[model samples]
Target: MAQVILTFFVAYGIVVGGALCGGIGAFLTHKPPLLSMELLADQLKIFGIVGALGGSFDSFLQIEKILIGNFSPVVKQLAMIVVAFLGAHIGTICVQWLVQVRS
Candidate 1:
């Protein structure tokens, strides 16, 4: 359906955009954006795209879980968006550091 496709596109965009921001931040800080391609490949092989996407949207998922009954819909959505960006940014930094240290 159109809705499902649109949703996937939006999620992908958010995740990738966050990653790009993180990479840029690292570059600005003079840190190399090192990534372990082999490990990433292995994770992809095991988890598949759907699983990876779910992982990337963890902030959204968690926020949805915790805020579903207590907060206004708009508030929950906005909070998730903020958390997702921050989570991805932090995740990228940690991953790059891990790869750089391992290699």
Candidate 2:
């Protein structure tokens, strides 16, 4: 129970961190501050929603078992966090591309 809650907290933190890094990269690359902030918020929201979905399902667990062939809770949590972060980062990029296209 506690562990499950902790896993979600840690995963969310990592996803937010990744989003912050993405925002910083955008700013450093000369993107407008407003756009960078929007990207950051969008990424965080996307990651959180996706993470929640994944947590609610067992698909990631099955994938984790297939890829790692073990059932270590810690490893599963870590993998979830990584995948969540990556999904958020990729989502941010896609949003940026869409914004550029629309402009």
Candidate 3:
């Protein structure tokens, strides 16, 4: 539990700190950096919180375990879909611009 929380914070720091460094570099070189560091900081906080919640959800799930594959299929399916959507959305939103820039 504590380990997961610590990892989330550390990961968030790596993300925001790297973005800040890149933003500062761009500012020094007179480039726009695409997005402001402040905006990125706000986004990182949101992203980290959501990520932690999603990752820790299973641990906190308060459902009784069933025998012979008798879990709540609807909830399981919904969770899977939600997680997939989140993964795709994050990948697309985060990397779309970078991909375009490289082309």
Candidate 4:
């Protein structure tokens, strides 16, 4: 139980840190959404409330694995999940930069 709690804490920290960095970087980049160029263009509709803000983007990749019928080990799956999240956050920040921000 302690180990499980510790793991959860660690994971939480990483995710939170990543999100903060990503969000701030994204703000600095001021890039618009790939799907929408205007403010409040609404990009979350694509996820249909399933993947709301703060949710890890890794989820999509896990779904992809299920669709692809590719069986990865538990550890590998976890790694992929982490990778997905990191990539998404980083990519989001980059996108923001590309669009250019006013503030």
Candidate 5:
């Protein structure tokens, strides 16, 4: 339970932080900050997931366990991954709303 929540927050933070930093970089380079943020948010989703999961080794392990007829850990891992993805997505939406770049 705690681990799941932590994973979600970690993923969320990664997206939000990455987007904000990217926006700053764009601003420094005389580009559009909001557009850069939106683009970075999209690009950072997979990174957020992988980061929250602490890299891909555990996920691969879960897959192996699933193939070996043990489903509980794999199911929990899947749930965590889903929650992490939701967190990253929501963070992107938040950036979009902040920038008012999307309808």
Candidate 6:
């Protein structure tokens, strides 16, 4: 329960933080900050998900455990992954909204 919620926020933070930092970089480079933020948000989503999951090796280990008929951990891991995805998606949407509002 707590882990899932933590995963969600961590994933969300990754996407939002990465996008904002990328936007700042774009501004410093004389490019369009909002567009860069949108792009970075999209790009960072997968990274966020993977990061929130703490990398793929643990997931693969979970899958192996599933093969051994231990289903609980895998289910929780899947739930965490789904929640992370949602968090990343929402973060992307937020960044897009920021772009839309600024434009």
Candidate number achieving the greatest lDDT relative to the actual structure: 5
- The residue pairs that clash in candidate 5, if any, are none
> For candidate 2, lDDT tens digit of each residue in 31-68?
77546655565747655645644654564555556556
Regions of candidate 2 where Cα sits further than 4 Å from its true position: 49-103
Q: Which has the higher lDDT value, candidate number 2 or candidate number 4?
A: 2
Model 1 lDDT on a 0 to 1 scale: 0.45
- The residue pairs that clash in candidate 1, if any, are none
> What TM-score goes with each of the models?
0.35, 0.40, 0.36, 0.33, 0.91, 0.93
Q: Give the TM-score of candidate 6.
A: 0.93
Please provide, for model 3 over 1-103, each residue's C-alpha lDDT reduced to its tens digit, 9 standing for 90 to 100. Answer: 4544444444455445645666688789987665554445445554544553455465234233444455785455345434444443443345334423431
lDDT per residue as tens, model 6, 23-53: 8999999998988999999999999998988
Model 1 RMSD in Å is: 10.8
For model 3 the TM-score comes to: 0.36
For each candidate, what is the lDDT? 0.45, 0.57, 0.49, 0.41, 0.90, 0.89
What's each prediction's clash count? 0, 0, 0, 2, 0, 0
Q: Which ten residues in a row have the lowest lDDT in candidate 6?
A: 94-103
Residue 12: error of model 6 in Å?
A: 0.5
| Candidates 2 and 3, the one with greater lDDT | 2
Residue 53, model 2: Cα distance from true site in angstroms: 6.9
